[model samples]
Target: MSGVDFEQVMQAALAADAGVAGIVSRRIFPLSAPKGAPLPFITYQRVSGAPEAVLDGDAPCERISIQIDAWAKTYGEAKRLAKAVRGVMAGAEFAAELDEDRDLSDEEARVCRVSMDFIVWA
Candidate 1:
């Protein structure tokens, strides 16, 4: 898939996750060029209703970590964008991490990192 395609997939997947009311905010970081560097990170915090499993004690508060290195063209750019995006999510109720080692296919190279955070209940 192309970088744009990868980004769309990631966004769609996150938006469709269970218990997500809506995206409170979103940020994109443009990274420097270089492969294998950390990509921009995206975090989404829940807006309402606790995870059913968490309430039932069947599972802890749902913490999801999704890494999308497919949209970056270089390692430096990915890392830079990841950090920049994470900065955007600072003080958010949710947390996320960007994996630096992963690289998307050539077609999936882009220049920005996307991060979001959602709070289930706050």
Candidate 2:
């Protein structure tokens, strides 16, 4: 955690996976996607995790809470993209683990979205 680049680690893990790379082409956005962008993309945000304390001046254990979203034109595609994301996250060594998964689709926008929450400890 002291010398770790959390975001780079996550991005590298995702890019290294063939399944995820093929689907999204490493189009993982931070915060939001571009206007009039293409479908089948990913967006993620980092939220602050709960504070931690340690006795005897030990390095405190901290966690990074990240929310990942997959957006596509169809439900199946969105789900596939999410599955790829989950796979990458699961196989990574950030001390990251899955927390929750949610579906957030908008029919009017013709966009299918799947949200996944994961925790990485430092």
Candidate 3:
């Protein structure tokens, strides 16, 4: 991951995919979305990562854990967004290989959320 723009690549991948962009429209963000932003947006962050170790040193590739949160006003929309993310990133080996996911709500905000975790060799 050294010297790589992880967030930029991730953002591009999401934004370029029609399945994701049709809903979010490049609203994908790193770490968090802006305050009071629009609904059905997305936020992603690196939960954990490690260099691919070799017998003597680090390798170019890495093992990374990425978490993506899809937020919307309806539970259905959140789930749809997760599916799109999983589809678009399947080749990237990130969002596709979902190890865990949960449907949630923000009581105060009254919004639906689907949080998913995926681990992959990036």
Between candidates 2 and 3, the one scoring higher on lDDT is 3
Q: Is candidate 1 or candidate 2 better by lDDT?
A: 2
Instruction: Say which prediction, candidate 2 or candidate 3, comes out ahead on TM-score.
Output: 3
lDDT of 1: 0.36
The weakest ten consecutive residues by lDDT in model 1 span 19-28
- The TM-score of predicted model 2 comes to 0.88
| Candidate 3 residue-wise lDDT, 63-91, digit = tens | 77889999999999999999998877786
The TM-score that candidate 3 achieves is 0.90
Q: Model-by-model lDDT, in order?
A: 0.36, 0.83, 0.84
Cα RMSD to the true fold for all candidates: 12.3, 1.8, 2.0
Q: Could you give candidate 1's per-residue lDDT for residues 1-122 as a string of tens digits? A: 22333334444444344322122123322232244544333333322243336454755344343333223445555555444444433323343333323333344455443333322211
At residue 83, candidate 3 shows an lDDT of 93
Model 1 TM-score, 2 decimals: 0.31
Q: Name the candidate that leads on TM-score.
A: 3
Stronger candidate by lDDT (1 vs 3): 3
* Candidate 2 lDDT tens digits, 20-70: 889888787888999977888888888776546667564466677999899
